[model samples]
Target chain A: MKTIKNGIFNENPTFVLMLGLCPTLAVTNTFEGAYVMGLCVLTVLLITNFIVSIIKKLIPENVKIPVYILLITTAVTALDLLLKQYVPALHETLGIYLPLIAVNCIVLGRALSVASVSSVGKSLLDAIGIGLGFTLSLSLLGLFREVLGANTITVMDGISSFTGYHAVFQVFPENSIIPMTIFQKPAGAFLTLGLFLAFFNYIKEKRGAAK
Target chain B: MSLFQLFITSMLTENIVLTKFLGICPFIGTSKKESGAIGMGISVTVVIVLSSIITYLLYNYVLVPTNTTYLKTLLFVLVIASTVQLLERIIKHHFKQLDHLLGIFLPLIATNCAVLGTTLLNVNNGYSFIEMIVFSLGSGLGFALVIYIFSTIRERMEFANIPKCFKGAPIALITASIMALVFSRFF
Candidate 1:
C-alpha cells in the first residue's frame, strides 16, 4: 500500500519524476487516446518489471544495461503487434508511439532502479503502483486538454465495438461557446504540463511548510 | 517529394523535436547550456545518421529475408546502443577535443527516442537509400537547430525575472510551447 501510494502521489511519474514526457504530451490530445496509451504503458510496465525481477540475478553486471534494453524492446514489440492485431483503432491512434515505448525511460527506469534490486513480489507491487500513478496522471491531463480544447470527453469509442457499446460525454453543445483551440495543439501540451507541474510544486511547498 | 523539399520539410516544418516530439528528454535536459547543447546535438546527429543507415540495411536484408520484421524494434535498438558505445570509444581514442565536448551525452544518445524514431520512420516509410540519407540528415539538423536556438534563449532567460514556482522547467516548457507555436506557422 505504501509502495502504491509512493508511485501514485509521492513519485508520480508525470508530475514528480517526469520520466515519460513524450507520450504524456503526445497522446493526451484526447481522453480516449491518452487512456489507452496509459493502459498500454501500465501493461508493459507490469510485465517488464516481473520478468526483469525474475532474471535480475542471472544478468551479468557488465552487460545489464544492454540486456535490459533487449528485454524492454522485445516486450514493447510484442505488445505493439498484439495491439495491432486485436485493437487496430487504438493501435492506429498510438502510431509510432507504440514502437517508441521501447525507450520510454519510465519502463527502463523502473527496470534498472526497482526491479533489479528487489524481490519479485516487491517489484510487481511497485510496478502496479507506478502504473496506476502514470495512468491517473495521463488521464487527468487528457481530460483537461480535451475538455478545454474540444468541449467533450471521450472515454471510449471503437473499442466499444468489442463490448457492444460506445461512450462519449459532451460537456457543452457544439457552438455553445468558443473552445480554447490551443489546448489541442503541441504548444497546449507543454503549457498544460507546465501548469500542472507548478501546481504540484506549490502543494509540495505548502506541505513542507506545515511539516 | 524532391530531395531538397524533403530535407527542408524534415528540418523545419516537421521538426523531430518541436513538431513530432520524439526527443524532448534531451532537448530539455541538455539544452540548459549552449555549448553542451551543441555538443549533444552533434553527437546525436552522428548517431542518427550511422544508426539509420545500419538499421535500414539490417531491416531490408536480415529482417526482410527472415520474415521477422517484428524484430526490427529489438534489433534496431541493439544496433543503436552498440553504435553509441563504439562511437564513444573511437572518439575518446581518436578525437580528444570532440570527445571532451560530447562528454557523457554520447552514451545517452543511445536512449534518445529521436535516434530510434528516425530509423523506424525510415524503414516504415520505405524511403530509398538517398531519401533515407536526406531524411536522417534533415532530422539531425532540425534537432540541432532547435536545441541550439532554445539553449541560447535559455541562457538569456537566466537574467530575466521568473516566478518562484516556474523558475526552472516550467519556464523552459512554456518557452518551448511558444516556440512550437512559432514553428507550427512554417507548415
Candidate 2:
C-alpha cells in the first residue's frame, strides 16, 4: 500500500520523477492516444518488472544493463506485434511511439531500480503502483490537451468500429470559441506540462510549510 | 532526397528534440551548462553516427538475410550500449583531455533515445548508407545546436526573475515551449 501510494503520489513518474517525458508529451495530443499509450506502458511495466525480478540474481553484474535492455526490447516487441494484430487502428495512431516504448526510461528505470533489487512480489507491487501512476498522469495530461485544444473529449472513437459503442463527449458546440490551437501542437504539450509541474510544486511547498 | 536537403531537414526542420521529442531527457539534464551541453552534443553525434552505420550494416547483412529483423530493437540497443562503452575506452586511451570532459555523460549516452531512434528511423526510411550517414550526422549536429542555444538561454535565465513555483525544470520547459513555437516556423 505504501509502495503504491509512493508511486502514484509521492514519486509520480510524470510530475515528480519526470522519467518518461517523450511519450508523455508526444502522445497526449488526443485522449485515446494518451489512454492507450498509458495502458501499454502499464502492461509493459508490469511484465518487465516481474521478469526482471525473477531473473535478477542470474543476470551477471557486469552485463545487467544490456540484459535488462534485451528483456525490455523483447517485451515491447511482443506488445507491439500483439497491438498491431488485434488493434490495428490504435496501432496505426501510435506509430513509432509504440515501438519507442522499448526505450522509455520509465520501464528501464524500474527494471534497474526496484525490480533488480527487490523480491518478486515487492517488484510486482511496485510495477502496479508505478503503472497506475503513469496512467493517471498521462490520462490527465491527455484530457487537458484534448479538451482545451480540440474542445472535445475522445474516449473510444477508433475502437468503436469493432466494438459498436462510440464514446466521444463534445464539451461545446463547434466553432463557438476560437480554439487555442497551440494546445494541440508541440508547444502546447510543453506549456501544459510546465504548468502542471509548477502547480504540483506549489502544492508540495504548501504542504511542507503547513507540516 | 538530396544530401543537402536531407541534412537541413533533419537538423532544423525535423529536429530530434524540439519536433520529434526523441531525446528530451539529456536535452534538459545536460543543458544547464553550456560546456557540458557541447560535450554531450559532440558525444551524441559521434555515437549516433557510429551506431547508425553499424546498425545499418547489421540490419542489411545479418538481420535481413537471416529473417530475424524482428530483433532490430534488441540488436540495435546492444550495438549502441557496446558502442558507447568502446567509445569511452578509446577516448580515455587516445584523448585524455576529451575523456575527462565527457566522463559521466559517456555512459549516459547509452540511454539517449536519439542514438537508437536515428538508427531505427534510418532503416524505416530505407535510406542508403551515405544518406543514413548524412541524416544521422545532421540530426546529431542539430541536437547539439539546439542544446547549445538552450544552455545559453538558461544561463541568461539565471539572472531573470522567475516565480518560486516555476523555478527550475518548469521554467526550462516553458522556455522550451517558446523555443518549440519558434522552431515550428521552419515548417
Candidate 3:
C-alpha cells in the first residue's frame, strides 16, 4: 500500500519535480514508447538502488559522484544490451534515449537521495515508488503529446510498415485547427513541459486558495 | 549537407533556445534584467563553447581512444561539472557584481539539459570540431536572444493584469509556447 502511494503520487517524477525531460519528451510519442522507457528506467532504478544501498557504507564521500555514475552507466548499458537483444524494435525507437538513462537523474536521484538512507527492503519499495511514479509521468506526458501532436495512440510494433491509429480526442478538421508546430520539435518539448509545469502550479495554487 | 550549412543551420534553423529548446531553464529563470541576461548569456556562451571543445577533446583523445565510449556520458558530465565548479570560483574572485547575478545560475548550468543536449548533439551529429564551436556559439546566442525577449515580456507581465492561475509559470509557459510558435517563422 505504501509502495503504491509512493510511485503514483508522493514522489511523482515528471509532474512534481520535472526530472529527466530529454527522454520524456523525445521518446514519449506513443503509449508503447512510454511503457518501454518506463520499464527500462524501472529496471535501472531498482537494480541501481539495491546495489547502491548494499555498497553505501563502502563508498567514500569524495568519490560518491563517480561511483554513482559508474553504477548508472553499467546498469543502463546492460539494460541497453538486453533490450536490444529482446525487444529490438523498442531498442531502435528509443535510440539515444535508452543509453541516456545514465543521465536521467531520477535513477541516481532516487538512489542517492533515498536508497542511501533506507534499509534494502525500504530501498526496494522506494525504487518501486519512484520508478512507477516516473513511468506514470512519462506516459501521461506522452498521452498529451501523442493525442495533440499526431492524434494517435499506438501500442506495439516490430515492423517498419506497421501504422499507429488513434481517434482525435479534440476534433477539429485539419483545416480549421491551427496545429502547433513547436510541439513537434525541441521547442515544443520545452513548451509542453512548461505548460504542464504551469498546470501543476495552477492546481497547487487553486487548492491552496480554496483552503 | 556541407560544412557551412551545418554552421548556418545550427545558428539559425535550429538555434538552441529559439529552435532546439535546449537551455530554456536559464533562458527563463536567469533572465530577469536585460543586462543580467546578457552577462548570463555570455557566461553560458563561453562555458558552452569551451565545454564543447573540452568534451570533444576528451571524447576523441581519451574516451574513444581508450574504447571508453561507454563512459562518454559520465566523462562528459564530470568534465562539465568540474569545469563549471572551477569557473564559478574564477568568476567570484574576478568579477563582483557579475558574480552575484550569475552566481546562482552558474552551478545550475551543470544540470541544464542544454549543456548536456549540446554535448549529446555534437557527438550524435558527428560534428567536426569547428562545427561544434559554431553550434555552441549559435546555441548560446539563440539562448541569449530568446532570454532577452522572454525577460522583456516577463517584466511587462509583472504589471499586466494576469489571471490568478496564470500568474507565474503558467502564463510564462503559455507565452513561451506562443513565442516558440513565433520563432518557428525562421525555419
Candidate 4:
C-alpha cells in the first residue's frame, strides 16, 4: 500500500523523477495515446523488473547493463508486435516511441536500481508503483493537452473501426479563445508539462510546510 | 528530398529536442551550464553521426540480408553502447581536455533517445547513404545549437526572479516551450 502510494505521489515518475520524457511529451497530444503509451511502459516495466529480480543472481556484475538492455529490448519488441497485430491504430499513433521504450530510463533504471538488488516480490511491487505513477502523469498531461488544445476529451479514438472517436466533453466554445490551439502542438506539450510540474511543486512545498 | 532541405528539416523544422522531444533528458540535464552543454553537444554529435553510419550499413547489409530486421532495436542499442564506450576511450587517450568535459555525459548518451531515434528514423525514411549522413549530422547540429542557446538563456535566467515552485526544470521546460513555438514557424 505504501509502495503504491509512494509511486503515485511521492516518487511519481513524470512529475518527480522526470524520467522518460520523450513519450511523456510526444504522445500526450491526445489522452488515449498518452495512457496507451503509459500502459505499454507499465507492461514493459513489470516484465523487466520481474525477470531481473528472478535472475539477479545469475547476471554477472561486469555484464549486467548489456544483459538488462537485451532483456528490455526483447520485451519492447514483443509488445510492439502485439500492438501492431491487435491494435494497429494505437500502434500507428505511438510510432517510433513504441520501440523507443527499450531505452526508456524508467525500465532500465528500475531494473538496475530496484530489481537487481531487491527480492522478486519487492521488485514487482516497485514496478507496479512506478508504472502507475508514470501512467497517472501521462494521463494527466494527455487530458490537459487534449481538453485545452482541441477543446474535446477523446474518450475513445481509433481503437476499432466500429465505434470511432467520441469527444465526450466540450469545455469551451469551438471558436472561443479559451481553448488555445497551440496546446495541440509540440510547444504546447512543453508548456503544459512545465506548468503541471510547477503546480505539483507548489503542492509539494505546501505539504512540506505543513509538515 | 534535396540535401539542403533535408538538412533544414532535421535541424530546425523538426528539431530532435524542442520538436521531436527526443533527448529531453540530456537537454534538461546538461543545459544547466554553457560549457557542459557544449561538451554534451559535441559528444552527442560524434556518437550520433558515427553510430548512424554503422547502424545504416549494418541494417542494409546484415539485417536485411539475414531477414532479421526485427532485431534492430536490440542490435542498434548494442552498437550505440559500444560506440559510446569506444569514443570515451579514444577521447581519454588522445584528447584529455575534451574527455574531462564530456566524460560524465558519455555513458548517458548510450541511452539517449536522440541517437537511437535518429538512427531508426533514417531506416524508416529509407534515406540513401548520403541522405542518412546528412540527416543525422543535421540532427546532431540541431541538438547542439538548441542546447547551447538554451544554456545561455538559462544562465541569464539565474538572475531573474522565479517563483519558488518553478525554479529549475519547470522554467526550463517553459522556456523550451517558447522556443518550440518559435521553431514551429519554420514549417
Candidate 5:
C-alpha cells in the first residue's frame, strides 16, 4: 500500500521526478493518446522489472546497463508490434513515441534504482505503484489539454465497433472562445505542464508548512 | 524536397526540440548554464550525425536484406549507445579541447530521445543518403540553435523574480512555452 502511494503521489514520474517528459508532452494533446501511452509505459515497466528481478544475480556488473536496455528494448518492441496489430489508429497517433519508450528514463531509472536491487515481489509492487502514478499524471495532463484546448472529453472513442463510436462530451457551447486551440499545440503542452508542476509544488509547500 | 529546403525545414520549421518535442529532458536540465548548453548541443550534433549515417547504412544494407526491419529500434539504440561510447574515447585521446567541452554530455546523449528519434525519422521518411546527411546536420544544428537561445533567456531569467513554487522547472517550462510559440510562427 505504501509502495503504491509512494509511486502515485510522492515520486510521481511526471510531476515529481520530471522524468519521461518527451512522451508526457508529445502525446498529451489528446486524452486518449496520453492514457494509452501511460498504460503502455506501465506494461513495459512491469515486464522489465519482473525480468530484471529474476535475473539480477546472473547478470555481470559492467554489462548491467546495456543488458537492462536490451531487456527494455525487447519489451517495447513486442508491445509496439501488438499495438500496431490491435489498435492501428492509436499506434499511428503514438507514432515514434511507442518505440521511444525503450529510452524513457523512468523505465531505465527504475530498473537501475529499484528493480535491480529489490526482491521480485517488491519490484513488482514498485512497478505497479510507479506505473499507476505515471498513468494518473499522464491522464490528468491529457484531460486538461483535451478539455481546455478543444473543450471536449473523449473516453475510448473508437476502441471497437460499438454504435456511435465516440464517447466524447462537449464542455463548452459551439463557437465559444473559452476553448483555446493553442492548448492542443506544443506550446499549450508546455504551459499546461508548467502550471500543473507549479500547483503540485504549491501543495507540497503548504503541506510542509503544516507539518 | 530539395536539399536546401530540407535543411531549412529540419533546422527551423520542424525543429527537433521546440517543435517535435524530442530531448526535452536535456533541453530543460542542461539549458540553465550557457556553456553546458553549448557542450551538450555540440556533442548531440556530432552523435546524431555519426549515428544517422551508421543506422542508415545498416537499415538499408542489413535490416532490409534480412527482412528483420522490426529490429531497427533495438538495433538503432544499441548502435547509438555504442557510438557515443566510442566517440567519447576517440575525443578523449585525440581532441583534448573538444573532449573537455563535450565529454560529460556524450554519455547522456546515448539515452537522449532526440538521437534515436532522428534516426528513426530518417528511415521512416526514406530519405536518400545525401538527404539523410543534410537532414541530420540540420536537425543537430537546429537543436544547438534552440538550446543556445534558451540558455541565454534562462541566463537573464536568473535575475527575474519568480514565485517560490514556480522558481525552478515550472517557470522554465512556461518560458519555453513562450519560446515555442515564437518558433512555431516560422512555418
Candidate 6:
C-alpha cells in the first residue's frame, strides 16, 4: 500500500521524478492517444510486477534483472498483439513507439524497483498506482498538447470525432497562431518540458516561502 | 559503399549524440568537467561496442530461431546491466587509480540511453555482426566526441557570468540545440 502511494502522488514518476519523459512528450498529442498508451503501460506494469514478485527469490541475485526483463518482454509482446487486433488505428499512430516502450525507463524502472522491495500483492498494487500515475500525467500532457498544438480534440480521426468545445483548444484562429511549431516537434517537447520545469520550480518556491 | 565510408558517416554524417539525441541526461549532467567527460566517453565507447556485438550475436543465434525476438529489449538490457556490473568489479580490482577517477560515473552506464540505444539499433537495423560492431564504435565515438567538446566549452563557461534563470539544464539544453543545429547542417 505504501509502495502504491509512493508511486502515485507522493513520488510520481512523471511530474515529480521526471523519469519517463520520452514517451510522455512524444505521444501526448491527443487525449485518446494518451489514454490508450497509458492503459497499455498500466497493463504491462501490473502483470510484470505480479509475475516477477513470486519468483523473485528463486532467481539468483546476479541474474535477477535479466530475468525480470525477459518476463516484461512477454507482457509487451502480448500487449502489442492485443492492440493491433482490437484498436487497429492506435496501433498505427503508435507505430515503432510501441515497441520502443520496452526501452522506456519507467516500465523497467518499476519492474526493478518494486520487485526488489515488496510482496507479490504489494508489487501488484505499486504497479497499478504507478501505472495510473503515469496514465494521469500522460493524459494531462496530451490535453495540453491537443488543445494548444491543434484546433481540434480528435480521437481516432476517421473512425469518429469527439467534437463540440473541441475547436476552442486552438489558442488562435487558423493563421493567427504561429504554432510555435517547435512545440510540436521533438525539440519542442524538450523546450516545453524545460519551460514547464521552470514553472514548476517557481510554484514550489512560492509555496515553500509561504510556509 | 566501403566500410570506411560507413564508419566515417556514422561519426560525422550521422553522429549518435547530436543527431539521434539518445543520451541527453548524461550529456548534460557530466559535461560540467572536462576530465569526467573524457572518462565517460571512453567507458561508454567500450561498453557500447562490446554490448552491441554480444547482443547482435545473441539475436542471430538465440532469439530469432526461438521466436523470442520480442524479448530482445529485455534481454539486451539484462546483458548491458550485467556487463556494466562486471565492468565496475573489474575496474575496482584491476585499475585502482583509474577506477578512483571514474568511481561515480561507472554505474551510470546502465542508465545512459546511448548504450541501450546502440544494442537496440543493431538488432532493429539488422546490421551484420561486423556492421554492428562498427556502428557501435562509431556511435560511441561520436557520443564521446560531442561530450568531450561540450565539456571543454562548459569549462570556459564556468568563468563566464550567466543569468539566474537559465543556469543549469536550461543553458545546457540551449547549448545542445545549437550543437544539434550545427550537426544537422552536416547531414
Candidates 1 onward: DockQ, in order: 0.79, 0.75, 0.35, 0.90, 0.90, 0.26
DockQ of 6: 0.26
- Residue A147's lDDT within candidate 6 is 65
Tell me the tens digit of each residue's lDDT in model 4 across A1-211. 8987888888899999999999999999988898889889999999999999999999899999999999999999999988888778778889899999999999999999999999999988999999999998999999999988888876677565434545467777757575777998999999999999999899989999999
- lDDT for B126 in candidate 1 is 95
Give lDDT for model 5.
Answer: 0.93
- Model 1 regions more than 4 Å off: none
DockQ of model 2 vs. true complex: 0.75
Stretch of 10 with least lDDT, candidate 4 chain A: A158-167
For model 4, what is the alpha-carbon lDDT of residue B84? Answer: 94
Model 4: chain B TM-score relative to the native chain B: 0.97
Score chain A of model 6 by TM-score against the reference chain A: 0.85
Model 3: which docking level applies? acceptable
Best by TM-score: 5
How do the residues B60-138 of candidate 1 rate in per-residue lDDT, one tens digit apiece? 9999999999989899888998999899999999999887798689878889999989999999899999999999999
Worst 10 residues of 3 chain A by lDDT: A159-168
Off by over 4 Å in 2: A161-164, A176-178
lDDT tens readout by residue for model 6, A90-157: 67777555665666677778878776678988888888889988888778767666666665555555
Ranking by TM-score: 5, 1, 4, 2, 3, 6
Q: B95-141 in candidate 2: lDDT tens per residue?
A: 99998788778899897888888898999899998999999999999
Q: Mind giving the per-residue lDDT tens digits that candidate 3 earns over B39-153?
A: 7777777678878889988888888778877666667777777888988999899988878777876876766667767887788778888778878877776776778788888
Give per-candidate clash totals.
Answer: 0, 0, 1, 0, 0, 0
